[model samples]
Target: MSPTAAPTLRVERSLLRAGHGLVAGVDEVGRGALAGPVSVGVLVVGPHTPAAPRGLRDSKLLTPAAREALVPALRDWAAAWAVGHAEPAEIDALGITAALRLAGRRALAQLAEPPAAVLLDGSHDWLSDPPGQALPGLGEPVLPCAAPPVTTRVKADTTCAAVAGASVLAKTARDALMARRHEEHPHYGWAANKGYGAPEHLAAVAEHGRCSQHRLSWRLPAAALPPAPRGARAADTLQPPVGPGPGRGARGA
Candidate 1:
């Protein structure tokens, strides 16, 4: 879709006609952050749902202020909406994919009714549970209801109104959370970077070491500098890998 184009309900309307009374749009945020929780937002729409706000688009395409402004309208537009998060520790224990499922299920659980069908932004069906697969650290099913069938669309966040709204809600919610976390640990610069691989946040990790909020399983910045020389002991280094780090050419915050 063009950058200036607005998302439409065409895709959603199609699903509503496919014998599904309720259709949900699903999206995630903070999956790549060095700290903070991975969040998922679910927005349910039904046959009578209205068009989205005029400027609604993918969260990545909208500015922070624009996204913040759309939240109230988006929330009011949906039949039901909810946001959920999997903390850094959960990410470490269950890994990102499982964490995303956990967060998505949590959001779905908050809805007044389970969606008859789910419309996911990405091409991968990450939200559905594998057959006979047990919940890892969580130990129990996130929802008592049967899992709803999901349909994945690449770039749906940009093409689908409901998906875009979900992205905005998830992004704004996670940003607020990281901003609050920044108040307690000012050095991470989370208020601005939102815990992505921003240079300053990496530098802070390199200097102060990983804190409780950091995903300990992921490679973080080293706590100290390299060894003084051959005669000196080598300083400690972090083990978790930064998926896209400074050396790898950093991605957006």
Candidate 2:
């Protein structure tokens, strides 16, 4: 399907027909960001689900205003929805692939019940456990319930309405998070760049060194980073939230 075309429930409906009573569409945001948490969104739709509201598409195609505008409609349309995040520290401790799975599992855990099956946007099933390679203390059976069957589709965010809705929810929540964090570290311009490696962001990292929000394990720019100012929280001291709410009270969306 064309990227600009409105997403349809054709794929989700097919899953319903195949006997999956509750199908969850899954997508993630901020996976490539230089700071802040990686977020995953799950939007569950059943056979009774209605058509998506107008103007819905992949989150990347929508303006910030447009994505924020659709939040209410998207929430109303889905049987259930939730967004989950894995902090930068978690990303640095576990690899990005494992961090994505961690975030995805957290999202799935917020649902009223586990989905019968999951429709993931990308080709890789980053939502599932790594089989025998599970990391100690952080991996192996991290899923809240038994892992649901997953079906990965390339470009599912553009072609599948449910997955597209998931992307929208995830993007809005994560963007709001970065915007709020911008208040604490305005030099990085996270409010504008959303923690992606914008030129100004890279320059700030070079000048001021990494902050508590930056993923320390990532290959950051090679520059002499100064020590944190006196009384400033160290980058490694921040802790991840134990809950699924992605700072809902601070949401700018």
For lDDT, the strongest prediction is 2
Tens-digit lDDT string for candidate 1 (141-168): 4342334999999888899998989999
Worst 10 residues of 1 by lDDT: 244-253
Compose the digit string of candidate 2's lDDT tens values, residues 58-93.
999999999999999999999999999989888877
Q: What are the C-alpha RMSDs, in order, of all predicted structures?
A: 4.2, 8.5
What's the distance in Å from true for residue 66, model 2? Answer: 0.2
Each prediction's Cα lDDT score? 0.82, 0.83
108: Cα error in model 1, Å = 0.3
Model 1 CA lDDT for position 249: 24
